[model samples]
Target: MDSYAIKYIGLLCLLLAFVSCKKKNQNSLPETMKKDFVTINYAKGFSIEKPASGITIIKVYSPWPDADEAFTYALVPKALQTQPQLNEKEFDAIINVPVERIIATSTTHIPALENLGVIDKLVGFPETRYISSEATR
Candidate 1:
């Protein structure tokens, strides 16, 4: 495909992603929901936390080489009616949980996305030749 076509597709994907995610959850999250979480012990790349029920907080540290700081994001379950109020500076983004789509840069992330049953959500990736998965290609 030409550059124009590639750009158009990427833009369309982004627009579609944005539109699909704009819906609000009609039910408010349960106040009594318990926190369920996994412990991140070895990987310095990221850490996960559950500060509240129906919310998952992720902090990625030095995701890239020479990165000085971590990026934080809040993930709320789709069933949640409203996002909990949080300090603005605490998170880079507050996204609905169970992401609908993704654009992967590194091939290392492909397997995980696939395993999560979201590989079909791959909107774009560079160097298609490097991708061995027939499903992805």
Candidate 2:
């Protein structure tokens, strides 16, 4: 074969190798988010992706009325179980699994959080008097 043809074939092989490596990396879970997790069906403004073990990435777009900014939160599931050995730098929030403590600002979030059995995690609410939850009462 001609030298030019040989060089082209070598380059093509290298490109193919690079592409395969990238696909493999994308398909493999990162060390932090490898464990099992529940799928969250979120609204239009938010989406989730698990790229590693014990971690979840949340993307929020225009989450607030009249707001134009988008934000991201990297959450660690069963945080207490993983946080001891986890690199905290990998996540934006490290809420304990079966959450134990929380401060609530809106009653709107109560019912869903309560139904999840994690409402007990609320230790404080700014409007305690407004809350009528039988569990909290």
Candidate 2's TM-score reads 0.55
Give the alpha-carbon lDDT of every model.
0.80, 0.69
Which residue pairs come into collision in candidate 2?
32-53, 32-54, 33-52, 33-53, 33-54, 34-52, 34-53
Instruction: Report the number of the highest-TM-score candidate.
Output: 1
Counted clashes in each candidate structure? 0, 7
Q: Candidate 2's residue-wise lDDT over 42-123, tens digit each?
A: 5476677766554566767777899877776665566436446555565545555445677888887788778888877788
lDDT of 2: 0.69
lDDT (C-alpha) at residue 107 in model 1 = 87
Candidate 1 lDDT, tens digit per residue, 1-137?
99999999999999999999997876755655545567877776887877556578888888799998889988878887365566668889888767777889998988888798888888889888888888877
TM-score of each: 0.56, 0.55
After superposition, candidate 1 runs with Cα above 4 Å error: 1-38
